[model samples]
Target: MPPRTEAHAEQQPAAVAVGKATPAAEVEPPGKVQVTVGGAEEAGSEGEDDDDDFDWGAAKHIFVLSNAGKPVFSLSGDEQRLSTLMSLIQGMLSLCADCDNGDEMESISAGSRRFVFLKRGNLVLVGVSSSLVETASGDEGGEGGEGTGKEEDEAAAAAAAPECESFMRLQLEYLYASILFLLTSKVQGIFLKSPGYDLRGLLGGADTSLRGIIELAEPSRGRGRMLAGGVETVWMDPAIRSRVARNLQAAQTASAPSGALYAVWLCGEKLVALAQPRAPSHHLSSRDLLLLVNYVATQPALRNAESWTPVCFPRFQKTGYLYAYIGFLEDPPSSTLPRPPPQGNADQNSPPAQHSDATAGTGSIADENEGRRGGSASADGGTQSNGSGSRSIERDSGTEAGGAAGDSCVILVSVESSSEQFQAFRRTRSALESRFRSALGTHWDRYLGSGAELEREGILTKFCTQMKALHFHYCLRGKQGGAPCVTQCLSSPFVDHELASNPAAQHRVWGYYTRAALRVRRGSCQEGRVFCRRRFEGNNGYFGGGGGDGRGSGSPAEEGNGASEEELATALFESDPVHSLAYEVGDEHTVVSLFGKRDGGAGGGGRWVSSSSAGTGRLGGGDELHVCFPSSVSPEDAYKAAVRLTAIVRRDRDWLFLTGTGAAK
Candidate 1:
């Protein structure tokens, strides 16, 4: 796939036809094959593809499959069928819309089912399913939701550990809460962290990063059988996530968990947070730098846990303040390592009625004979590619970002590098968060002294200490009956979006972190396959090659002139969320982000003066980039650009027939 040239015109709104799946390319030197870029693509309606009918009966099949008669244990076939059905529906939503123009369609899963839509795009979707025992959705069998509120309230009150309260309540709420009603005509798209957190329906007008995160996720894929079991929101103070790092050190356990609890959640292309744990033994040693460097290469990716490995986000020492690297995927690339900003999602104070997380107001009216679960499409997640020019990465600077990570969680690096790391880190962190939550709930404070809260909760400090040292590396992802998961897009049912053969349109695939994850138009059909597209642009041959010579693919007319770089590539599929949709241009492959690439793609994505420079980061031989809408551009430009893109790759085609059916004869 070519590097993802997400050079859409964001200043103004425009309609953009979908692009295609190209591999993430590598970067070389400038004056060579350069991928010139303009503003982000315009916005347009992504007309829905043909969708398969929803199967409402699978729920019963699932109950039978479990043989336990306990519905919760059984992943109802009906749900899977509906999920597949919804994937088809929302995936092609734009085609169904009356408006010729389209909206952003970010993906978010609230309740049991996953969802697809846009954040600010033209479409929105809301999905609900059952997996979480008490999450926003409910199941008929076993220990699912339907528990008494009095019992839950009592449990919350009596729970000795403050942390435990959340588990008890979270589990129940996950099961019982009705899907919310955030999706409105005005909403661009709603992105739910997961069913557990998505109490309300799809929210309207969320941040662009939310859109970006999901867009980069499965452009059109989901796992109907899988479940992201955990809380959607973490109301605790930010410090808590970091503080645990310092706390790890103070305890002084022997075999400390090699990794810390660093988390990167770019749910909808938003680089949420990258927090590393700090052990008491942390030092500015080479080994530490290596660990940091490894992770440095991590966070800039799409933040999809399924594809990459995780690093215990390092922590700071001095102040109880554990510094973490936090930013929105939309932040400018030229800016400094950013501090945490306020939340950017839709209204959450009082979750919607369907998403009350208590009782599903009234049971959803079922058609009985054809029991299709009621749902909607919302926020989305995904994965895709790398794009850019070239770079002879020297080991010296490659480790720059690592050394600078420091004891403080402050991870300072260029925008390009950050984007890549964001992709990888987000994925790992999401997996960790989900797994950790499940572990703690199932183990019931297995780590005794691990935390003050756990200590007080009647868990042995020794056990807690031991528990904190290790983690759930997602070893069980595919342990069910076969090998483990390989990429983010291929997670069994819940995440599997039957791969479509159409061009790379909105919310079609599951991996790589780009905006594709959020663009489900509605009524799209699945092709059931993983795909790869290779697209390279012949540089102007600036690297001593013939000027204006075509080196990549396409023809003379397509190549054009003005020293355009090769079309960057990206590997977008249907599964995987919170990962990066990478891109690289010019001779330098560093991420040219609005935050740091102030010189435009000029300076090699410079390193942080501090430790971020340790590693000579090679982001597919390009600069670290962060897409930010320039205030100058007009929304009209975006609209026009989108229209142009659509025109470039329309779905159907026409040809002159030798003779008309009747008239010809």
Candidate 2:
């Protein structure tokens, strides 16, 4: 039987009456109890209550509409039901254009809420955020304290507004890019030709993907990759990754007329390997790659069965579409397959073990069987017991081995679609799958296991003692004259006791990092300069006072003499130790470092000297390095720690980045 497609699944009734069940009577006369229909009393009441209780004012809202005031999509609430609000937004935009002498409406601030408008051809996208810190009212302050305090507050508020709006605009751009990715940029022309056209119809059911993109855009989710505009690669053994890449290349070469332009392998959200055309210009851009990853991840139906869909890489070529063949590698059926007998108990009738060195003389049973069977095992392949113990051997035509049931590994191949070309490509896909499986041995079970080993050997653990932050994100841009690539690494302690016990501290730490990232990307911050900001001094203190005196040793009293409140605050800001820092190193690189609260007062005093040569000299001119440090660590110590971390990353660049030739050498 063919696999059920999403549309077919959706068309099936949610419930069926197996045994001639009848609906209960709607009402009973007088004192008789009323009969509930379908045995669902207040069936959707909880959902209704959830919708009613939802804090719409607090959550971010994204809306897409036509110039003719037709609603297309809304991140929150139903777009069709929100027609009045959409119409008002359209009218407001029209007023802005009419009153401003044809100028476009970019943003509008009303108290704490800000609305950002982005117009693309005949469509309009508006993003609304209520999370902005409200500007303090001047009337609240006494007459004597009004001047400098209010001015400073106003300046800070002004700085924050633009940053929030800029990020909102970026979110809208991603939303619009997602639309263009689904239906090429020609969508604009479609709307231009017919102003009253309903775009939602053309979008089919892509709103789910757009909603996912919005969720990822949230500060607490997606992390630095969303902010840095890069893709996060799966961490694997360099040798294994290289072998996978080489096999992908070999597969492409085997099917010479396959028309396969690019092949990508993904283990969940992280990329395992990618093989693009030798031509540098044909590579996928980071933005397009991110969108593609999001699409695959958001759509559960894609995971259910292999799919051939048309996808457009807007950054690659907005005018054209590429046919993508996406298939998930199935795990070998170990239960039904014959297992070799235990060591020392092998039956006399079993064939003698033969060494198989088809690829690199690994002597694996799967490889040996494939060789003996002339590269094509029979329907019922032979099983040989090795001295080690009972082990399952995969047949030549069976599914690939390794990975848990829940684990997902997908292979995506893209090519220009054509009747003859697609048929040829289908055959190539089979050959590629076979070769891909043959390249990976049973060792995948060891490497792709629980991932504890990966975390232990990862950069986070390597420098956990030195850089004591809760989270870290690193991006390594491709070297000069190579294909544009951005390799990313993100780590956070999943087993940290303090973070697990104190949820607020976790939220605060991420907030600090998010704000620092915004500051780094803001236009006001000059390039090649390190940006540092102190964490907020709340009652719970950093890390919920898990260890040590949460406050640092560099207190205002130690600085000598009587100090004013402002002086003390400044001293605390400089010495109390914050969790995040941002340093923009030219146009193509950035380093955002974060720190957690200290454990046992580890870091101490050091002078912070701002140097003009800090970015180029101290940072080692790398792509991006984001780390976390203890809150008790002084700013100067954090800076020095970041420099040390950069040196360590530079030394291991080969293992960290996936470069032009293939996996990192």
Candidate 3:
């Protein structure tokens, strides 16, 4: 987004630079060795040594520790060695509380680094980041005062500090939520019983989950999912989506427990379908869905077998645990295996057939373990244990011939765990798989097999062709039965290939949109705003803009103070066009449109393309569309393309979004 501040420039080296070797005379013999957590480098034998070696001030660092000063998890360094730092953090909070009549410290700013603190139950979460506030000195007017330029700049920085701190706060909140997802709020009881309890011992295998959340929360990697608080969805045909939903609904009705809340179907990273309770208030939130998906994607163990885990959806109910029965319906395709045969019309009355080859090929540890445990299938479609006297059903292979290959289909059901309903639930899960596979038939292979590729070649291709846009991300927000729901879509190439080689450029582009979105939400762009840099005549104007260069007609400030919405619309609709335009349409929508050419191209010059369009719109309204267009495309042309895209979305809105009760489509 904005250029790195002076602080980032100064501290960046510490984050990436390797440490110099100490001489034998200077270096002391190794003391009691501390094991590194999550494969991170040891933070050193002593706190002072750790501080000297670790660049805590450089990259973002997250710490979850007990109020008793016990380190739980450290994102960057060894928590055991960082125990001293954890104690210092606790001391600061205690000092703040004692001094401010129990008012805790929320955030602390030290030069370019900012530390934000959050307390949940007996635990304290801390986030330290070098990310600083955008100065905006070139655009925002300086308040009238008899102060030096440095003083004014400092004041501006102080005023903008809250924005960066808020982001850090959000990161900490997500981190805490992830902990709750794993341990539930009941973790508070453990802390209450034993304040010095080592939470790390309990969270032993959750390193990947915690790290995945952190990575996704990072601005550069997540690409606005955390900022927008929404999940990316897989775009599919309305009819097929409807069928998928119907099957999920049937499964939920036939098999789900009375305590069932929601049943979600996911293919890879994108949500495919969801079946929630009739009460819209009971629906799962986009934020929870995003977290759940990320957690699943990160945990390879989950892919190998069915799991019964206690997951907390903070938005739904933060106080307790919801039992999630997560199972993969199909194994992700591999190059070595032949594609599984389509669903067969086997007689329902026939005995269940065993597919040992499919189970072996899929490499399910649970199946092998169960086989060793003397687990056997009963006549009633449930597994009976001969040794432990426990009951569990073997997850349906969902194939008559061999292991299914393509996108892995994950079915996650959230319900209250009960011993009596457990067996029935397992049986229901098997039946649901049968019903779902039967409904999709050959289309299952076609869609899950090559759905992503098809999307790139299908509607997305058509839209990009007409709009001349390089990438697009759209999140539609609305209320269903008074609960907020969101549907989102991202261009295929945007996530995978386009600009893949140039991460800095991609970050810059996304950063522009994110900042513009924040500004629009804050009502700062009432008269519209333009963010562009005039460098080398239309060379990546949006990304390359704002930095002062003595080449353009007007100062950066003058260019930023763009025309009013009405005037800008007139200019775009008519003849005159601008490089960047940001305006809000009433309270419900905000649009930020940018046009620019990449810096490097085939002939020493690049074609300007419409880059980004972000806004909220009412369902079925043309104004609800968010799109990106090529720089060559005029505003009018972009508008027309948006209209076309809107129509397509409108026609498929039911399937596109997880709306009301059964089969929203």
TM-score of each candidate structure, all chains considered together? 0.19, 0.64, 0.62
TM-score leader: 2
Cα lDDT, model 1, residue 368: 14
**Candidate 2 lDDT tens digits, 601-644:** 21233332222134422332224455555555555665666655
- Model 1 bad stretches (over 4 Å): 1-217, 220-236, 248-505, 508-596, 599-665
Tens digit of per-residue lDDT, candidate 3, span 1-665 = 12122221222212211112121122232232222111232333445755754564344788889989999988877888788778777876665555423344555444334566777779999887653444464233333344557666655554333225445556677787788778877888998999999999989889888888878754345555665555666544444566667767656666534734677777777777777665544556555777788888888767555666778876566678887776666532332345433221111122333433212112111222232222111222222222211233344366542464334554545565775445545555555555555545544544455434453334444444434455555444433323334434343244225554655345434444544443432323211122111222232332122223312211111112111111111111111123233432211122344322122321122222223332212122111234544445565665555544544444444434444332341
Candidate 3 clashes: the total is: 9
Roughly what TM-score does model 3 have, to 2 decimal places? 0.62
Comparing 1 and 2 on lDDT, the stronger one: 2
lDDT of 3 at 580: 30
Please, what are the lDDT tens digits per residue for candidate 1 over residues 180-273? 1112222212222222223122322322222222221122322110112100111121222223222222222211222223333322211112
Model 3: lDDT equals 0.49
Ranking by TM-score, best first? 2, 3, 1
